[model samples]
Structure formats: C-alpha cells, structure tokens
Target: MTPTHAARLVRELSQPLVSGAFLAARDRERLLEVLPSATGETLDAFAAAAVAVRRARIGDAASLCAIVSAKSGRCGENCAFCAQSGHYATNAPQHPLLPPERIVAAAAAMARRGVTRFGVVASGKALPDAELESVATALAGIAALPMAADASLGVLSEDALARLKAAGLAAYHHNLETSRAFYPSICTSRTFEDNLEVLRACRRSGIPVCSGGLFGMGETWADRADLALTLLEAGVFSVPVNFLSPIAGTPLANRPVLSRDEARRIVVLLRFLLPDRHIRICGGRPTVFGRDASLAPMAAGADGLMVGDYLTTSGGMPDADRQGLRRLGFVVAQAG
Candidate 1:
C-alpha cells in the first residue's frame, strides 16, 4: 500500500468503528504508519484506546492470579528455555508435589491477600494417574474458598482432565512456548502438537484454557506475532506473555534480555490484535520492568497480572501489586 493509504488505515484502527477483520490482520504498514508517529501523547492515546477496548470486553476490573509450584524439578523433557526442568542443571528447587495441606494453605494465603484465582503448576511432560489424583485431592481441600482454581500440569490425559474439572478446576494453562515452526528449536523431547493436545483436553473437559507464549528467546518478530495468532486460533481465554529470563546453566543463559520498552510494545501490539482476551504480564516482570514499572502494563491494556512470587523466582509482594493498581485508579475484580 502507498504511504497515504497506510496512514489512513492507521487512523481507521485508532477509531473505534473499525471492523474486527482489520484488527485481526494487524497490517504491518498500518502499524508502521501509526507507530512512527507515536510520541508520548500518542502512546497515551494508544493506552487509552486499549483500556476502552478491555473495559468493554472484560470490564475495567482487573483480576489477580497466583500460582504455587506444587511439583518442582526433575522434569523429563529438555525444554531449552526452562530453568526448573531437571534436564537443565540450574539450581531450581527440586521436590515432589507438596503435600495437600501445604497446597491448601498456599491457596488460603493467596485468598487472604485478595487473589481470586489460584493456580497449581507442575513441571513435566504429563502426569500419571497417581499424580493426577494427588492434584485432585489438593483442589478438594480449597473448594470452600471463593477463588477460582486452575492447573498447569503439562500434557494431560482425558481421564486426568475430567478428574480435575470434576474437582472444580476452572482453567488450565499449557503454554505453546512459541510458534510451531520455532518450537522444535527450543524443545526436543516434545512436539508442538503434544501441547495442543493438552489444551484440547482442557476444552473437552469443559474447562477454560489459558495458553500463551514466551518472548525474547531468539525468535523473530514474525515468530512473536505468529505465537499470538496461534493462541487466538486456539480459543485461549487468558494469554500470559512471559519474557525469557535466561537463568544460569540454561541454554539461553547468555542471551541478552529484552528492554522494558520492547516488552510494553509487545503488550500494546497484542492488545490491538486480541482486543477482547485477557492479556496478562507474567514471568520475568520484576527483572525486566523493575518493581516500579508495574502500572505501565495495566495502562497498556493488560487486564490481569500474576501476583506474589513466580515459579523459582521472587516477584513483588501481593500488597504492593494491589497498591500499584489502586494508585493507577484501577479496582481489582474478584473472580466469579
């Protein structure tokens, strides 16, 4: 398209009347036209537009989600990007699944801190029936809490998914990690389709799926865009954009980290594309944006955030996150 046409398209996108098709395509020429003109004022304009979009779809209310590393380390698959998998010699804490009491206590603590969604994450390819039963038992203890329960137990069987759903699991998280074309380069032990199957299993069991990708792991911009579009196609209810942390002893340890501006740019671009989905700022937030930079994401259309500490890493405290949201004039929404 000509420069004039591109400029016109960008203006059209900025307006609320544009069709969904235009946003879905997210034409590069249109983005370039507007991005070049994005001064501080334009950035705020974009942010305001994103907030309006988010409020219309999911409301101005933000949700705080927390996760517990129930089962840590000794993972079989060698996903070159992960720090917790046993395949990498990183000093990630390794232990069997925490006892049910500990899991229940963690859930209760998160509730006390105003977190409405509780997630349990395990590191491995998939869980056996015994392991699934263990997770189900943990979910049962916290059934009384108003918080919504979710799990990230790797690839799951039909029976496992059913049992978790029956135990009141509300959502399931299985990251695509990256685009299918680039997935093999990062993980050798598992296929991209294996992850897709797990998401499909979640859907089959009538649970909402929360799937997303990690950025800055030696992927091209096209790769990042492809990952976003893939998640859109997969019907993911929540998208957690995690930047690569490059932990010591991992294959990507020497890789350069992403700047906070670049991370925010991706979040803004994702808002333009997935205008109605829950876009969360997940792992690597503290290291990338610093603790003070939390509200920049909420201003850029992020509707949810992972609260408390992340797996094997310390994030900001829950009270601090709540304060940040309040300072920005955002009200934390309780999970239904």
Candidate 2:
C-alpha cells in the first residue's frame, strides 16, 4: 500500500477502537495489514489508536507484577530459547528451591517498591515432588506479604495447585509460549497440549491464569496471531507478551533482536486483539527496546508491566519503571 493509503487505512480503521468495542472480523483483517509493516508512519498511528483502546477499556493505570526466580536451572525441557534448559550446556548453575524466608523477602522487596502482584517462577517441566513441601512453605510466607501472590512452578499437578491456593496463591502462570503449530520448533520435551491442560487444571482449582508467549523466535506473523487467539479462547486474563531474550550457549543465542517498532507493534496488535485484558510487556522489553522502552510500552497500548528481574535475566529496575509510569501519566493500580 502507498504511504497515503496506509495513512488513510490506519485513521479510518482505528476509529471504532476508541469506543472500546472489539475488533470486528473486518477490523481484524485491516489490522493484520496495519500491524506487520516493519516500517511506517501508519504503525505509529496504529499504536496511538491502540493506546486509545487501552485507555477506554482498561483505563490509564498500569498493573504491576514482580517475579522471583524461586528455583532455577536444570530444567529438563528443551525449549531452545531458554537459559535454564538442561538440553544445552548453558553453564546455568542450579539453585535449589528457595526457603520460605528468602521467598518472602523477595516479595516484600518488590512490595516496598510499589508492586502489588508478585510471582515465584521456577525453571522446570514441574516442581520436584521433594521440593513441594518447601515450595508450600514459601507460599505461606509469600501469602503474608502485602501483595497478591502467583506461582509458575512448571506443569504443576492439581495437588500442588491446591497446596499453593491454600497457602494464598491466587494466580497461576504458564505460558503457551507460541502457537500450537509452532510448538514443535520451540520445544520437544513438552507439547502445547501439556501446558494447556495445566492451565485448565489451574482454572479448575479456582486460580486465575496468567499465560502468554515469546515473540521474535523466527515464527511468522500468523504464529503470533494464532498464539494470541489461542490465549483469548483459553480465557487467559493476563497476557505477558515476552520478546525472545536470547542467552549465549542456548540454541537461539545468536538470533537477531527484533526491531523496536516491531516490538511496539506487537503490543499494539495485542491491545487491539484483547482490549479488556492485561497486555503485559514482560522480560525482554529492555533487550528489544534499549531506550524509551518503559514509556514506549505504556504509550503503545500496554497496561501491565512486569517489574524487577526475570527468571534468568535482569530487566528494567523497579524505580525506573515507577518513574516511567508517572512520566506517562499512569498510576499504579493497587494490587489485589
């Protein structure tokens, strides 16, 4: 499309979004055209429209969630992009399941920094049976913290979910990672069905699920849209959109970083797709957007921010996140 045509398309198509009505079949078709352009004035216009949609649907406040790497490394999964997968010689030192005191301390730290929803995420296909008691003990401590608690302890059994929910866990996080069609290329140790069942189990156990996927993994745009549609169908409330943060010694280590505009467009696309849901810009925000990433995300239709470090990597500091939120005229929503 010509630049003029692109401009008209964005201006005309983005109008219905301001009413907070979801994209109709035709709107989705037009946005599929508007979102994939790697370079354009249209993308900026689309992003602004997305932000308007975000404000109208979810309001201007950003929800914050902090995560602790409660357990790390020695994951049996062969997710090629992960630093903690045991399939690669990444030199990631294994850390045992943290004691309750340390787990509580991390929650408290982020709570003090104005965070409300905190998660304890470990690396593995599932928590070891031997570690469940310790993890339960940690959840007890996390429960007492002045924040909401969530956990991602791998493909947890119902018993484990019960244990966690009893100990004050209100949410469960298990990323679908990508489209089911793209799952084989991302990991062989686990199927997309495996994760889906686990998420279903969490919901059955009465815990809300926070599921999302990584982008920039050499997948097609169709893969990205398919993943989003799947998550929406699954009733996932929180969509933590993670960009691939490649680690050295991992299979995808040398993968090129995604363009900042593409990253922003992904956020815009998701906001357009899931207008009322939490479209969180998680983990790799710093890697994909080196400067102005914090505000860029909020400006471009994201209302959820994962503050603090990630499971195997550092992220934008909590203080910086706070400043950016304030600069962009966002108030931190109180954590439930």
Candidate 3:
C-alpha cells in the first residue's frame, strides 16, 4: 500500500470492529495505523470500540490465571527485558524451589478466588533435576484441585516435558518474547528458535502451548506484526500479551512504559490476527495501561487475564479484579 492509503486504511480496519467481524491478516498494516501513537482520549475511544468486538466473538466470561514464583532470580540468560537475569544487578529475590506443600497451597488459594487456571513461574533457563521432580510432584496435587495447572520452567528436553505431562501439567507457558529479527538484540544467551523447540516439546507431550511476547521494548510496528505471526505459526491456543515493565537495573531499565494506546493496539492486532485464539493480557498491565488498565485490555479483545502476581513483580488484587469485571459486565470464570 502507498503512504496515501494510511488514512483510508485506518477507516477500513475501524469499520469491521463496528460491523462485528474481525479484521483479517491482510489488513494488519491498516489496523496498525488506526490509532494515533499519542496517548489521549482518541486512543481511548478507539479501544472502547473493540469491547463490542471482544464481547461479540468471545463472550463475557473471562479466564483469569494466577502465577506463583516457584523459583526466583539467578537466571543465566541475558534477556534485556527481564529483571531476573543474573547478568543484571536487578537485586531481584533469589530463592530455591518452594516445597511441594507451599506450592500446593498457592494453587489452592487461587482456586478459592475463582481462578480457573494456575501457573508456577520460575526464573532461569531451566529447572534443576531435583527441583523439576519436586515441581512435578506439586503438579500432581494441583491437578486434583479445581484448577488446571501450567508451568514456565524455561527450556526443557522432551523427556522432561513428558515427565511434567505425566505429573498432570495441562499446559506449558512459554513466551516467544519477540520477533526473530529483533530477538538477538534483546538476548544473546539463546535463540528464538530455542524457545520454539520447547513449545514443540510441550506439544509432543500432549500439552497445549500458551505462548506470547512482551512488547514496547524498542520493537517497531513491523516487529510487533512479526511477533503475532510467529505465535500463530506456533499454533498457540492462548496468547499472553505483556507490556514491558522495566526494572531499574536491567539493560532496558531506562525504557519508558508503553503508552496505554500502544498496549491496547497490540492486543487488538493479535485478536484480529487470531480471532478464535484465547488472547490474554498478562504481565505489566498495572504500569502500562494506567488507571483503566483492566477494562481497556479486555475491551481490546483479550478474553483472559493473568490476575495475580508475576514472576518478579506484583499484580493487581484478585478481589478488585472480580469486582471490576462485574462492573464492566463481564463474568470471571468459576474454577472448574
């Protein structure tokens, strides 16, 4: 498309949101240009329109998941966006794996608070063998509860994933993090394909893959497009849209938080690209989306949310989350 086509393109993309049909991949560029880059009421209004599209396609019941930090700090990889990287002096907590009972208690608490999904997120490239076994044992207990269990234990071998699946792991949480072209700039410790291999291993173990990326880390609009396409290529059933929450000691510590409009546009793009996929707004919402953080993201076609604490950061309260969703006319999924 020519430069002159941008204005008309934005109108084309905006029309579908009102018409109750999702924008197709062919129209991604036009969709990207729909909202102004500046943060203002215009951006807010554009995002508000997506609420109808989200409701029409995905309904009012939103899936909420809580994550407990099973292990903390001392990561070997140098992912610039992470506070947990050992290469950085972020002073993020360092702790060994939680005992099986403590992990089980965390999941139980989430289940009691209407969370249907629970995740155990750890720092580092992979868990040690003993910690893996202990975590697997915890999963067995978590499975018996009312919630589905997931883990972000970093890269793992096929055999390791098989053991996790055997331990009642319903899904594997892995974020591709960003596009292939921009990945190396963010981390030299591992290739983007290394993350993909882990996803394939999870699939081989009969576990569904929940994959996504953290945006607003100096990536361009094109990079964002590539991230969406990569997640679709991975055949992920769910996508966690994370906005960068820069930590003071990391490489990207000085990066500004994403404009609320920019964050919402990221979700809108993913929803348009994968209309039926479970689009979830994950880490960094509180700092990124301003006061109406929760409502704006859901309005942008995200059907799931990471409702509790993150791997190294705090999250919004689950009680406030439920009440906010109710006020907005959306139902929190009762734990199954």
Candidate 4:
C-alpha cells in the first residue's frame, strides 16, 4: 500500500472512533484486512491513529487494578500457556481457596496503593458450590473496601454469577485466550463455546465482563484481529490483553517471547478495534517489555493496567507502575 493509501485508511477508520462512533461492518473488515500489510512508516501511522482515538474516547488517566490467586493450581483444563494446570509439573503454588478475610486483606493492601479494582481469581474449570459461597463472602468484603470486586473463576452459570452479583461482584473475567479458529490448537480440555457461554452468562446476570486474548502463542495477525472482533461481538466491557509468558513444563514453554514492537502492535490493533472498551494491559507486560519500559503499552493506546503480581508470575511493583505511568504523561486512577 502507498503512504497516501495507508494514511487515508487510517483516517477513515479512526475518525469514527475519535468521534465516539463505530466503523461500518465493511469498513471494520477492511481495517482487519489492511493492517497486516502495514509496515515501516505505515504501521507507525496506524499506531498514532490509535492514540488519537484513545485520547478522545478514553482520556489520559490510566486505570490500575490487581488480582489475587485466591485458589491456585490443580486446574483440570489443559490450556497450553498456563503454569497452574494439573497437566504440567511447574513450580506454581497450589492450595485451596483462601478465607474471606485473607482475600479482603490482600485487596486492602492493593487499595492503599491506589488500585481501584480487585479481582478474586481461582484456578479451576469452575468453583464448587462451597468454594463459590466462600468467594461470594470475600466479594462482599472486597466491595466494602469501595473497590470494584471482580473474579475469574472459570466457566460459571448465570444463576451462580447472579449469586456473586448479589454479594457485590462488580465484574466477571473469563479470557477467551485466543481466537476460535486457533483455539483447538491451544486447548482441548474445553471448547471455545464454553468461554463465550461464561461471558454471556456475565451479561445475562447484569455483571460487566472482562474478556480478552493472549498473544505471541504462535497466532497470526489475523488471529489477533479475529480475537478483537470476537470480544467486540461478545460485548465485553474490558479487554485484558496478555502476551504468552511461556511457563516451563507447559506446552508453550519453548515459545519465544513477543518482541516489543510486536507487543505494541497488538495493543494498537486492539485499541483501534475496541476503541470504547477498557483495553487493560495485563499478564506478560513485564515479560514482553521489562520494568523500565512497562509503560510502552500506554503509549501504544492502552488506558488501563493490571498492577502488582499476576496469577503465577511476579509483576512490576505498584509504585513503579504508578511512576512509569506518570512519566508517560498519564494520570493514574486512585481508589475512591
């Protein structure tokens, strides 16, 4: 594509987004088709266009959120990138669910650091009835902290999600991990439909949904675009973009980490596609960019971040994340 063509396409696609409108279906399809061919200065133009939309639609404040692995390890699913799967023998921690008070205490510490959202995450196909009750109790305490109470407890029914909602659950997270066409290669224990069903249940229960994909697991640009479109179709409120960390003993242990440019491109693509959603940089930020450059995603169009430790990996300290975001000319959202 010529420079003129690339510039025109970027403007055509980004103008609607900057004005708080969506592109027509054909124009959106054209964006997915054209972006893969964008290179050199052309790609830079697309990135800049994404930044414009982000600034206009989402503003300059970067949101900070944290998650606790309330229950770790012993997962039955065989997602190839996870360290907490029972199919792997990695050194990830394993334990039953933590008590409600302990979970609330973790949130309290993060809240003090200005994190406005706290997720109670567990590693399992689905939490048992008893464990769900415990998580519900924890959700109540977390809600009292005046922070958003979120969870990623895997596939759950509408009734179960409504129970948590009544207990003050604010959002439900269940990542699609990747696109439907590429999903079977990454996981076989569960179908792609299962992931969608959980997100749908979240919507039916009136809980906001946080769903996204993991990049750098050998997916194509088309796969990334498809995942973005899927999240849009699912009507998720938040899209937590995670790159593959390639944990040891898992099937993807040997996969190479995505380069900084490629990771930025992923964020830019998601920002353009889901301009109005919360595109939060989550797991694999440190793995892909390291601490010193952790704010690169924000510069690329992301408006939110998952600060502190992740499920099975250490992450950038909250203080550093706050400082880095400030250096990037973005205001950090504080707990209200």
Tens digit per residue, CA lDDT, model 4, 185-240? 99999999999999888887888999998999999887888899899999998999
Residue lDDT tens for model 3, 1-336: 433454355456666755666566666755666543623554554455456566766778888888889888888999998888899898788998889899999999989889988988888898877678899989998999889988999998888888989999989999998999999999999999899898888877788999999988999878888888887777899899888999999989999998777787777677766666788888899888755665678876788888888877788877788778787788886533
Off by over 4 Å in 1: 1-11, 16-29, 32-44, 333-336
Query: What local distance difference test score does each model get?
Result: 0.79, 0.84, 0.81, 0.90
lDDT-better candidate, 1 vs 4: 4
lDDT of 1 by residue, 1-336 (tens): 545554455456745522333263546446644653454555666666666666666676778889999998899999887888787789998889898789989999988888988898988888767888788988877666878888899888888888988887888999998999999989989899988888787777788999998888888766777787888888899999888888999999998888766777677767777777899888888878886686687887788889888998887777888878877767875422
Put down candidate 2 lDDT per residue, 1-336, tens digits, no spaces. Answer: 877887787667666667756678777877786579736677777777788888888887887889989888988899989989888988666897888789889898888887888888888899888888787777778777777888888898899889889988878999999999999998998899999998899878888999999999898887888888888888899999899988899889988988888888888888878888899888888888875655687788899889888877778777777777877878875433
Q: Could you give me the TM-score of model 1 versus the true structure?
A: 0.91
lDDT of 2 at 169: 87
Worst 10 residues of 2 by lDDT: 327-336
Return the lDDT, model 3, position 170: 89
Candidate with top lDDT is 4
Query: What's the candidate order when arranged by decreasing TM-score?
Result: 4, 2, 1, 3
Off by over 4 Å in 3: 1-25, 36-49, 334-336
Residue 19, candidate 2: Cα error in Å is 2.7
Lowest summed lDDT over 10 consecutive residues: which window, candidate 4? 327-336
